[model samples]
Target: MPEVVQNVSKEGVKYIILGCGRTGYNVAEELAKETEDLIIVDKDEKRVEDLRDQKYNALVRDFSNPGFMDGLPVPEVAFILANDREANLAALKTIKSRYPATYVIARAIDAVSVDLLQQEGADVVLYPQEVVARTAIYHIRKLHSSRLALRLYDLLASWEGTLCIVTHLNPDPDSISSAMALSLIARHASHNKLNCRIVYEGDIGHQENRAFINLLDIKMERLTPQMLEECGYIALVDSSGPGVNNNLPKSTRVNIIIDHHKNNTQPPSAVADFIDIRPGVGATASIMTQYLMELDIPVSKTVATALLYGIRADTRDFKRNVTPQDLNYAAFLLPLTDADLLDKITSPSVSLETIEIIGNAIRNRKINSGYLFSNVGYIRNRDALPQAADMLIHLEGVNTALVYGITDQNIIISARNKDIRLHLGNVMAEAFGSIGEAGGHATMAAAMIPLSYFSMAKDKEGLLTLIIDPILKRFSEIVGLDGEGEE
Candidate 1:
């Protein structure tokens, strides 16, 4: 391992350990490196003086003061382990104030203190006791539940690590961002190749979302029959079932599924990989955040910002449907996120093309039987479909709004509704089946179709209308709003 390690051999790593008690000593022992990187500090002079006298790097002083941290040669990376919460936090604060550039990972006593440490500039926080307890309980439950037991077995099942097809349900910021982030993870493994493809049948619908898609360069390539046949490993991200938002190609035998939606039912295979589906959490991105923490992977600033944005956009910033996991992930990502990048992603300037789409939505809009409908065209940014749907829903007499558009090679639709009981995913699956695909939550929906659906979409309005109305009629029938014999 030492021979293979291609670390920068420029300078020796300097460690500033705050306590020499059990945990701190354990840390030092773990770091008993051949690189001669050793620095241990303890308050008891008599106990540590002998080591200092023998030429071992040791400091015998009560480093209780935040100022005491300045005297030590803090490494570019420092691991601080003080037993007491207040003392640990103080040492962390002092380390950051002095060595502002250090990558600090601190030992924490509880979950809440981790947040404080992060706020004080600690890059990572670990509560050993709490983690051990959670691990024990999770595994215990897994052992008892045969279903969970098999899935755990599957994650490591050396299917030479096949592709994990993850779906983003209701495909929000967090769901989509998490799917992309997980793709990066699956790609890093030696034998496994993870190809992340985004599939959305409805509109993103929000201006900020439209901006995020443009800035992040997120593209959804529709799945094909050949691609499905070739894939062996499968993972679901946000959405879960066939009858729901996904018509998962029957070949996609799901191995793992990480989600936070309400449970409909568990997936079927005995050898399934993992179902880290936590219903209590607000955002799936939060669940992915916890997984990253468990793997001890360092999230880049962009990843941090993206996860943070996902959580904020989904949970409305810890205000709604936020579980412990949601809060934990938000707390985890907040300090790591780049404030400027997040701001830029959240408030990107609208383009003239976007404005034109909005104009067309209004100019050709219609309202009937509580449904506001419109046919749009030639638009590039897929973000506007849902936004147009949402805007149309705001019309005085509208109960449902379905906005349709035709790009050169695709038929795009964003559906919005004030009806609280309808399942938009089911509605889309039934409506768009003949032409294309649609998937999203009840209040919001989106779909994508092949070029064949839009024969002369380039022709001003004639061709676009022919393609959109039939789909809308299908949707109306599915929702039981279509009159007489419509289909």
Candidate 2:
């Protein structure tokens, strides 16, 4: 950082760009559009002459000379981008010592030079190899995404009539936003010949999720038995399979699937015409955002806001299960999103059911050796289970939290863990996969067992009490506690 003065001479040049190589030339070209009060310097006489011919303020001078810039006014900033890394460092030190108020951006030879340049008073260090590597990765991903977008367009073009986009049961922000993006893609690709409808099976009872849908005016329908027969094509997003986390029948024929979950063992049963599931990504909305960019589709403010929030929610604000692609996609959407609407969607008031569920989870929590397990009693909204787990995991001395609740037809469970020694997703899958469907990322996971699995209980209340012990015991034992934490 450089010294901040209240005012400087408007007649003086604002920027001094040393080492007019490719990097420096490109930067100056862009900056020239904003102002002509800038100088481009290079030690090569021929290079400086060529730049001068192109109407640039180019100068040939040795940077090692302490008075090379003797006749010039003190520029506000200097860019020392040269291939000669050592020479760049020398120029940086000279500039900093003489013009202590000027900001200096210096190039580094390698990774090690980065630290040395910063220590030598360079305000910013630029490494050529790191810059090229990052740029190469972004272009490579864009190329791949472009090819995939073309395939998706071709598939949509071939289809006509209704196309149902099914999200996971009790749809969250990720699923809802991904569905919106897919619907937009379908309409654009098919030239509006396709009627895209978003469908889900469970209640949108989560307060934040409800706010997201309403504030964005997203249109969706509840899944019914007739929905399968009515829609000509079916696509699932956020959830990989037909029946894994959604109410779709296991045997239903799915036409398309786009999800980000890691499915190591149980792959989707229905063979689809198109499937893009990347386990490394944090959110399906990120994948959808990539499609929009590569295909050159117009994104509305509402859609961008939804997709941005979706990425943040699923990645825990880019803190969990995130990848480079997720971050890149989120950055692409940032400028297009509506910040005020995103604030409203994320900060919705909690519902009474959710508050009650969290209270029950805290009151009934049992902890032993950093492991905590709680039963939230009977719940109408299964989404509350994960909210409870997320809250309980913050308790003092608790490294893992497991929260379960009984619905009318299923026993839903959600767990969160921060312990380095445990992969919570694998633990949940191994403990409950035999009786129900379960699996997720390293930090978080979920499972759902049908009420029929515990048919011995005569009523819902009894069933809630009946399965608590076995659930705790199985989870504790699998994690090496051997039922020590069970009631």
Candidate 3:
């Protein structure tokens, strides 16, 4: 019989920890700093006593037995860190079955145990070794990024005169924020010697994008041929290569390129003095955030809000194709950001036409396998098509969504995919690259096909059918779907 330790006040205990081993003890010690409501349970009296000595609430009981957890207060979080795999699995199953609502975090000793724990209803199964290794790697990368930032600072310091930071046409938040961050870095490093300007070719039509620019007070101008002539060096921000989407001529000189999107085609790296293209990163804003942190620059509240919004928008609040760096930068910026401003930037009022367009998309949607296809007929707001596509992709069974509309003399297509196997941008490029201009990130892509490529139709339905049918057929074939079936 194990000796039962005196019960500590259970009034505020929110985290119930099973097992007082090294892992559990360490976790408890860290968590204890945050809250007083923590209880540690173990089968061994010695371990229980050790925890008690460390001033933690400890109990000696058979944690594997379901009855042992019956009378304990329902905790918000439960950690199962038993030394034996069988004991850990049994405790996890018992707690999950009894307290189905509790968030169970279990430690796994091996790969097999990790899978078994997850199967046994462990909400989060963590391998301590793997986590530690990842932490080490992340820190090492952080150091490398610091060095790279200093090198970039030195490089920028060498340049004299205006440094044009160009974004893709009709710049999104990611492009705008990235350009702003780069300009900030360049200005700081050059001590205002190097003049940096954000320039793009198209209109900022998206409501949220407009809010972001106005709220942040971002200064950007329309790009022209003459602008390039006066620029000492050109730096492409949130854009992979020149002439792909921007007004810059392909033959024009590009000194630097910083982008997070994967190049649809390989870029000529030799042409640019510096190129940092990280496709694994969720947003270009994250890449810029790292530079800001590495340089230890004081990030303004407005700038922090812009970067934060840019990251969240691009990553769909970290639900899309996000990486560890994205999460880290987001966390770094969260505290610095103005919450009220972020709310305003994110909660922009949508026009009634945008709402109607979304309704038309849902009504006209065709689902084949897990793919969704919709055409919003003719739309005045081209940006609304992508917004509609993003919304449609969240439907219960849909894994891929493609939304398109005829605007002016072009057919605009916006594609989004949650399925990891399909790269939507590559799909769009392959499907429409030959017909018109098309390219985007891995998960989201857009294409612009000129009306001249298709035969003119008399009515709206006829035009939609003529353009949308070929696109559906081509896209379906590319994604390995055969014979379109309506939902």
TM-score, every prediction = 0.52, 0.81, 0.69
Q: Write the per-residue lDDT of candidate 1 for residues 1-487, one digit (tens) a residue.
A: 0111122243434655667778877777667655446677677776466645554566665666766654455476677776788878877877787778877888898888978987887898878988899999988864554444233434433445346454553357886778766765555432344454555545565568766776666775455556556666666677654334565654456766776777454353323446676677898788777656655557877777778889888877777677776777788888998897778887777767777888888888877677777887667676777667767789888777878887666777888877777777668867885667666666777778777744644583566666566657787777767544311
Cα RMSDs, all models: 13.0, 5.2, 7.0
**Model 2 whole-model lDDT (C-alpha atoms):** 0.86
* Poorly placed runs, candidate 1 (over 4 Å): 1-176, 179-236, 239-249, 252-256, 260-272, 278-280, 314-324, 408-410, 419-439, 447-460, 474-487
lDDT by residue (1-487, candidate 2, tens digit) is 1112223345456999989889999999999999888888788889987987788877887787776676566878999988887778778888898789899888898888899999999888888788889999989976887898899989998889999999988888899999999999999988999999999887898888899999999998998888789999999998788876787778899999999887556565658999998888999999999999988999999999999999999999999888988999999999999999999998999989899999999999988889888888888977788889999899998999888888888888899999988999899899888888787767888988887756556578677786667765687788878545443
**Candidate with the greatest TM-score versus the true structure:** 2
Query: For model 2, what is the alpha-carbon lDDT of residue 160?
Result: 95
Top-lDDT structure, candidate number: 2
Which 10-residue span in candidate 1 carries the lowest summed lDDT?
1-10
Clashes of each: 11, 0, 1
Candidates 1 and 3 compared by TM-score, better number: 3
Would you list the rank order by TM-score, best first?
A: 2, 3, 1
TM-score of 2: 0.81
**Lowest-lDDT window of 10 residues in candidate 2?**
1-10
Q: Note the Cα lDDT for every prediction shown.
A: 0.68, 0.86, 0.84
